[model samples]
Target: MSLTGHLAASLHDRGLGGDQASAARALRAVHRAMAELRRGTPVLIRGGDHTLIIAAAETVSARGLSELGLAGIGPAVLLLAPVRAAAVLQRPVPQDAPGTEAGAVALRLPPALLDPAVLRSLADPTAERLLPAEPERVGAPALASAAIALAKLARLLPALVAAPAAEAASGRLDLLSVEAGHIAAYPDTAAGTLTRVAEARVPLEDAPEARLVAFRAADGGIEHLAILVGQPEQALAEGSVPLARIHSECFTGDLLGSLRCDCGPQLRGAIKRMAEDPSGGVLLYLAQEGRGIGLVNKLRAYALQDQGLDTLDANRALGYGADERNFWVAAEMLRAVGIGRVRLLTNNPDKLAGLAACGIGVEGREAHQFAANGVNDAYLQTKARRFGHLLT
Candidate 1:
């Protein structure tokens, strides 16, 4: 069935009405659009007064590029986040615009650069070849910026091939359509849609009496977990704040015991500390692997790191921010578990601010640094120097 068909059936089953149905439809469209972009297909993004069709530069196929060229609206352009544009153009671009961290860039997508492999090289810094041509820079419209944002959401490189959408061509192409506004609002909207779905008693080696509560979005997206050790919520009722840790899932480090980072120790140690606390605590295990850039992009960043770039710069080289995580979801999970105030266990100050911004009152910070394994010493140092993590 089509994505729209699935959404329509879901809405009908749930009997959603009015604004709820409208919001659900918008979320469904964005979700479907992400899936389409990942598979090398195009989607149309409609803004307040304009519309554009965009495809991921890293994944757009030859046929997709042909469709953009033949749209009969205007010449297709390449849109990249400002950091990436600087890397590709080998010069600094403007960063004065609001909400455009260092500003984004739009380059005219010439016919020569339309081949899938060529476009992939342009989007991925890890590619060996130089760009085929010196593309001219053009002003990026709002929808163009949205296009890059959509690529990032799809867990592809934050680069897009886009063109103005002709009404007739948009209809004829039968492309999935979503709103730029909805793309911007997706993280918080999806966070708001979460509800506690299930709970089970699963004692851990570090945290005996651990109960895992799973939170799922209405659309059945990835689930965030709350590992409750003892009585954190009970402490809240007794007017005492409990300990909390916001841990983004690290599959390599946490699961495979990769030595390039300290995630495994931090994760296990946090649980032990929370288990020992008389007040007890809750650990919000988020599914934001590689700080929310997704596992594949994280591995790409690691490849860049092997070439001597630090963690932060490695992420930038791949056209992502220093961190792409949305702590709003963590805040929502904490709120659901009746944890409004907490003594947070973390080394990164961003977690403190992130929770506070989302109305989660952080009582204080409990230092949680572990000794660096010989392999990850530089990685830990990079965290302290570049990301301002409190390692001491």
Candidate 2:
């Protein structure tokens, strides 16, 4: 591989060539590796994709292998092959190995190469297995808020990128021709010049970094968002500190007292912990509403729930994958928050591996399980028993 922009072009400009069923099949295959972390790659060869496996790294020493579990790399380590590869990815190949130089890694086929029972296994020794998940509902109200939030983004992202920079700083936005000037906010940084266009005041956490940047979308809608930052002492750590949290966005529960799905409770718990001394931690407070089914779908799922369906069944009936949410967004959010390492706060082992695949270190995990109550018993049980969550 000459690094001739092959992989980048494969992923970026060129989209997949397949029908709906093929696309779904591709995704479902990746979903299969939710059990043990497998290693492989998505080959863009020929008409169909294939997963090729690497065996050299899998032959790691016992000492190195022991670190795999105790490292607390979070959940999906066993399930997500890409994440598993990173968890066990070694650098500077052993000097004792023959013929190969140091750092010559043994790579594998991607999970997309799901078949291994036939001759293809000889060509690429890779396999796939299913892991599971059980996500609770974000309720009707939260979904509505999330819809509005996403809609606002859909309308404003273009203009905000084109708006004059002066307006961004002054909170007074001015539209200019896209060709003339562009005012794009750094995606990695949320603390740019914020103009109070809508006069919406976002309340804050006790810390100085706890101010939500409120602004008017180009659509003339008022929006407020709060960011929690660690203090100077915690912000600048010598080594990576592992951190994790079950961040349920605070549309109603975290802000208003809605006993819907413990979003409020979890948000409080995450903030309290994040406010502590900064150690590389994993806090995945995602913007995924109703686990990415969106507000309308979430409400629809709720309707099914009211009709005597379990939480998982309700989502399935509503044409969702039980967990429609993708953790990649959470991974990006964590990186934006200056989190490089983390001790994930979750019970779903899959989530751990997902974050690790996305490049966040998992030192350990702190289980976030709510006390059993009749109202949430079904939801909790599905998570612990069905979804493979480490509830106990």
Candidate 3:
């Protein structure tokens, strides 16, 4: 197959293409736009009847805003992470307002007041400002564009965009063009080259027989760790469906014992449980910190949680989905180790779905849960309620 044909096939597998050819074109367009946003460059986003030029609010400049305004794009509004919005706006957000969905709040500021200082301040994660007395016109497409831009820039999911327009506008804005080759190359580049970098005997407090194996991607994007307990390779060799747990990395709870979530206990507990099993198990430690939004945004979500938002709400407020992880890497790691099937251990149905979608067979599920602590009670409840995580 040609390079274009291969790219289209991959995009189709990812559900981002209509067909191989069209998918290749779409991938090129979206990939170029995403790359532009990552570099703090403004890009044009159009959907439905709206077209807007947007950049990541975290890095967007007064000059950038001025450029968009000169091109008839602004008085700029910010589509903020829910917690950031609440802090910056200095008021309780109304439940019925537009841009309130997914813990996101859009505030349109006066173009006249948007001096360089103010624009720079908006870029700070900790900075706060008063919202305008009256609402700014934020339509759905603008919100979507902001979401998409932020997702690419921050590695968050469910992208959205925000503009300074007080009302919806119609027209085609030809600001940039992308080639199919560029689009086809992104997925290939992002998939990276996965290679096992290290392996060693790592006796854990709970699982003394554990072995740690590390796999690094060529892009240095994320490194996946496999914690093998009780000879999983031997068990699989004997045709036993070894147990498996796919855990996303959590810096706060896993490392700091943050009571806001149950990640640490789950990590330790999974190892302990596998230690008792004669057949053993594998725990794939993914580098998808904060559900693929990275650690900084997780802290931003923590701030929103302090404002009484639930976990899902906090993520949404930050312009991310409830969960943004994809399990293809887990499947690949499993395949690399010569494992074909397993009894998956998880509370998240999405994990099972993700692995299955990536062609890994889950023969059964071992329900895993930890008793909720005082700080994480609401967090656990939110997971079960909003994200459909199975818990008792």
Candidate 4:
């Protein structure tokens, strides 16, 4: 079978088929739409029961808008962060306002402003904004699905904006079709069936006895790493449960030493702790940045955080659930390395639950915590309060 066909079959086996297929498909479409929007291309988004051409307000061009017949139909509505929304709309959006709960607001602009120059400003990436001018009436469930998809893409709260289905299908505007269901299945299956593509000894500043092993997904969507400290293989060979830490990749915090979260400390702390342990450990370095929202969206959430929203609320305001990460990849990595059980290191209970769900035995959890600084105090508090993270 071709690689695509093999991936499709694998996805189908991972519970993305049958009744759940629509939701999966919708998610894939959202991802595709996000990619297209990033390139300043408009995409056909099916929301409610209507299909609408949607693009990021920062990148949408006057020509792109005209191609979708948006200018001829009517004015476009801009969805944006409440602070920016209030600033742009020149109206006060009460904190207690109904839709303001998501920290986002939408404003309908005059159709006259759909020109290229105006659109370039509207689609500014630094400016938190979204344009939804056209709408086709669809069912509430469908609209909700589309909203969630859009939120995941923009990493902001959900907003209402879409192009008409008929206009989208007219072939003038470039429409990227999404096989969302198939794509959604890729992650789960990939986690279970990752192939080790490369491995090499890479000494870190603290953990000099570390070796990095890379695993590629069958569908080629994502890659995960297993950083072995000490002789994890030898430990496992002797029937010992190797210590392990499933650390999600954090560019801002891990790379830049940002104190907004405890990720950096936890990462280094885990490696240091493992280096000291006689059994050593394996740090499954996951590429699930920003709890799986990706780097740019995480920054968008940071902007929302600056506006007084907690970590969880910031993600929700951007149309995401509290945690979008999965631990199947970590579980699969452990299994691949011949370790069935582990002394998992983490403060989050979800990690335990996720690993357990994936059939990995968690022998025990080593309490992992870093001293709270002023910047991360609120963040730590929210993790404890909202997500039930084990932090004291």
Task: Write down the RMSD of all candidates, one decimal each.
Answer: 6.6, 21.2, 7.5, 7.5
Residues 271-330, candidate 2: write the lDDT tens digits: 556556355233444554665555544565566567676666565443234453444445
Candidate 4 whole-model C-alpha lDDT, 0 to 1:
0.65
Give the per-residue lDDT of model 4 (tens digit) for 92-170. 5565565443434445556665565565455333353434434222222223234334545444333334333463463
The lDDT leader among the candidates is 1
* Candidate 4: 10-residue stretch with minimal lDDT: 135-144
Give the top-scoring candidate (TM-score): 1
Off by over 4 Å in 4: 1-34, 45-53, 70-147, 150-160, 167-174, 183-186, 189-193
For model 3, the superposed segments whose C-alpha errors exceed 4 Å read 1-12, 15-53, 62-109, 113-129, 138-153, 156-193
User: Which lDDT tens digits does candidate 3 get at residues 181-276?
Assistant: 333333333433456889999999888899988887544445789899989889988888888999999999899998988999999889998899
Show the lowest summed lDDT stretch of 10 residues, model 2. Answer: 155-164
In order of lDDT, best first, we have 1, 4, 3, 2
Cα miss at 178, model 1 (Å)? 0.7
lDDT for each residue of candidate 1 in 330-390, tens digit (9 for 90 to 100): 8889999888999999999888877776778899999999998899999999999988899
lDDT for residue 273 in candidate 4, whole number 0-100: 91
Clashing pairs in 1: none
Ranking of models by TM-score: 1, 4, 3, 2
| lDDT for each candidate structure | 0.82, 0.36, 0.64, 0.65
